[model samples]
Target: MQKDKRYDQLLDRIENDRDELVELCLKLGNTPSYHAKERNVGDLVVEWFKASGIAASLQFITDESVNAVATVPGSGDGTSLILNAHMDTGPEPGPDATEADKKIDTAWTEGELIFGRGVINDKAQLCAFMIAARAIKRAGIRLRGDLTITAVAFETGAPSIDKDQGVNYPGEGFGTKWVVDRGVTADYALVGETSGFGIVRAECGAVWLKVRVKGREVYTPRLERGSSIQENPNAFAKAAHAILALEEWAVQYQKKEKLEFEGGAIVPKAQIMNVRGNDEISQASPFCDIYMDIRLVPGRKPEAVKKDVERVVRGLGFDYEISAFQYSRGHIAQNAGPLIAAIEEAHRYVFETEPPLPPSAEVSMWRDLNVFNEVGIPSICYGPPRQRDPYSGAGNRAMKISDLVAATKVYALTALLVCGVSDR
Candidate 1:
């Protein structure tokens, strides 16, 4: 009964602080922390943490990028927990961005929902972590173990490709890896991402490959026709054949690499992101580059996957070179039972139902969970769902305010359970 009373106090405190949590979410969602440029948002997070009396600091990964780390120290008797979320939003709008695209950075409220780019994808959960700690502090709950909240930069899956300039775009767990390597660890980690309030134990890793196909360069007006696409002298013609082959291979690959776990299934997928070639109109290109993004299930080796890709592309009878510019292996938590039990209990206390598994699509994508599990810290991804438009079948870059409050309660309760309360 005393434990139940403590849970009530924490939930009440979180409910009373809903307005402040919403304000923080809006503030964070309004800030444009585009990938690789998250300094401003990071500073805001630091200020909020300090004002709330939590000890906080920034781990600078680059001159313009930093990971915000905040903590509520415990008395060193129970296990520690890390609640992590990315500070950076999705990619910025390009030159031809629509008005809707431009509106992604601006936060707005309608009825019970908050609309913005980062609001649902991450900013909401980031704010929830901060508010959960504050609620614990306000409820006079002295934890026996530490509760650390991290807002890392560069959790976006974009690779660090150096083209015209230097390596300007550094992503794919860059900040999370840095903080982990620098000793910001815990007994377990809960990554706050868009998981539809379900628990995700496994996630697929990814590899970005650049497949270059070589051909003879010739003037467009003087180019000779060939009997088949493979015999054509132009790289673009041969690339068509390769693309078809890849399309066929991708269907089979997804079926062969599907992985199933207790939580859900991970269907590894592949796609040709872009095809690059010469832009000069008067000449046939000498070479074409196909950039591919391939997702791999846990225990799958990247080198083996690359070899499989090479075999498929080489069979097109074209001279080619394939190289993986970026790769990270997928992982499953080896000892996540304790953490899962804590979350499940907290979730049931908050929602009065059993927690469900996230959709297969959510588990198939990459997130910072992979980073924590890679360093031997058992981790899982959990957060609220994104509101979907019924008619348009499009996901709104928004989050429900009620969902935010519920997630905050669950996070605080989970922390209380995982990091046992102290008498002091």
Candidate 2:
């Protein structure tokens, strides 16, 4: 209704302004901050917001690389609405090593797609939101709620997952929780995660596991006599047994997810395995550690899975212990909330369809969304989406000309409606 009209109105503007958005993404992506470099990517996002007439600022969390922040302010609803993206990307951009540091590095571009480190992971999302903020300011529509955009760091690290430990919450860590503590209260939080035009209602939680296998060493002459090492304490053999057992348990866990959940597809179609990594054996040093990431289903708890993991290692009858453990609380905010409905209405207005629905199955990797969700925020993740264009497997990183135009229409319409523009 209201959303459709808004999209119809904003479609042209979204198309007109995409190149600017892509340029912003490239310049900033080149910043070493893509990983955890000294420079802060948040700095660039903040600059874009303020430069475009939005009230943007940085809230310092610390003096170190982890202590940075970025925000863009909006008008309306007295209550603030959040548009957030983590400032960090895993395996951050490597040294540019050359000057062609252009936003769409031709050297990095492949066919229709733009290429570069950190180009897709998140810099794209940040750019999309920045462009949206700029468009709203240029158009003069007032919002029902104030729009606040935040870009921060260290989302790829472990401490970043604890929502209860939000920034400056009198705790010692960085995460979405920290963003909340630093005054990012909003009616809803939108994670710009490149999920095409849909929302991610359920975020799969993660549990980190490290299994250690120690073996006894014996000389070949005495291998037969070593009680623990009839075959020199066959650590490899023990590891294989443990891995096989864990695989069996993981399968059962996955099956449980299929029967227990709805919506999204359980992809890669199974749990990830780091069954046995970094193994070593010598006459002097004999031990192997199997490190793995366990992405639990929305309703599943790592604690519940912990016992299963323990049972498997124990069932092997080999000595083992759970070395380190951490888990993310799963989350799903009713997509029908006034906030989401309005946003989706805006999306439908732009896309001319119901817009992609949220995924039902949890994603396999961990993300900052866990922090907001764990602490009870109706958090969901989304991002501009484009498969490899017809020309190739990639396209624009920030605003796929095709997807960006569509997303920009959605963003503009959603912003206008959510911000409370009285008429189209």
Candidate 3:
């Protein structure tokens, strides 16, 4: 079918409301929701949804986190559509912030880009969904299927390890899993993650592993030098060997394992993020800890990855205890589905060009879409245009203002098409 008048009308509406969309994006980006702490941002979403004439509610995931949910009912004869994104920005700079890092909390427009924490991480998606819902309402289009928007919490960082904070070692997909388990589900879910508007159907799974290497404590003088090293088992020395071995393993793994897709392939990766041993200067440390982050392509299980780590460590003849500290599975959705088709159609209509092929896996990262996919909901990530910060140390997170407008059009159009308009 050729492009329809409804698609053009929606695109025009999104373009005309560009200023409001930018304002909403700034509002969401400026509101800081650190980790499990998202009360203010969550409340803001709820308030906005209700004010826009959508049904809104807050579902508590924990004392510290809540999932803000909004819905527009359809005719009940078609598939329900879910527009999802996390409310939490990535790991906070903690309570202590240098003036520069603190500036990241404020959203500002510089030229054609909007700089802020959540703009690309997901505040942009949150606001885009809100605007899309509002456009559907403004156009007076009644969908045959229900339209639901879930602005979830903690999608940016790993699960809480702090028990006193009421979080007990949660990992990725924390909020989406909570909502799914709590009976908030849909036939199709469009995850608003930063993918430069690329449709993402697959992603790599990941796990955090902690390895402890044990050795006999010995005096410094007894530590062997050169060829004598065979007789001495210094924990620090053993850790050094283990770190090098792990690094080499990571290089080989990346070279050997790859999952190819339309645009690119995902390579499984392993890296030693941290290493620690006793601080005593006079003696060889008896134990050392190694922190490992392993990324696996979809179809590879975390258990298997754990086994691979154990195999490498055991091969080195080191007495060790390895544990999967935390883990999240990856997902692969159908290459073609109603949600994908609707999004592709929206992209073509909005950009007047063919959409890029869907990404193989969101490279190395995971999203709430993984959670929804696990629970049998067909989900994919499609959001505003963004690029990774070249300086990971200095905060320069940003996205194009034009990209936001285009994405809002795609999102609004996707919801309208997937939900199916009804005469009622």
Candidate 1 residue pairs in backbone clash = none
Per-residue lDDT for 70 in model 1?
97
Candidate 1 local lDDT, 9-104, one digit each (tens): 889888989999989988888888887788999999999989988999999877888899999999999899999999888677789877766666
Q: Which candidate, 2 or 3, has the higher lDDT?
A: 3
Error of 3 at 168 (Å): 5.4
- Please state the error at residue 43 of candidate 1 in Å: 0.6
Best by lDDT: 1
Residue runs of model 1 more than 4 Å from their true location after superposition: 1-3, 162-167, 279-282, 389-396
- TM-score on alpha carbons, each prediction: 0.95, 0.80, 0.90
* Model 1 residue 375 lDDT score: 89
Best candidate per TM-score, number? 1
- In candidate 3, where is summed lDDT lowest over 10 consecutive residues? 160-169
Candidate 3 local lDDT, 248-356, one digit each (tens): 8889887777878764577677788777777676666888889888887888877877787788888787788888767888878753388888988888878878677
Ranking by TM-score: 1, 3, 2
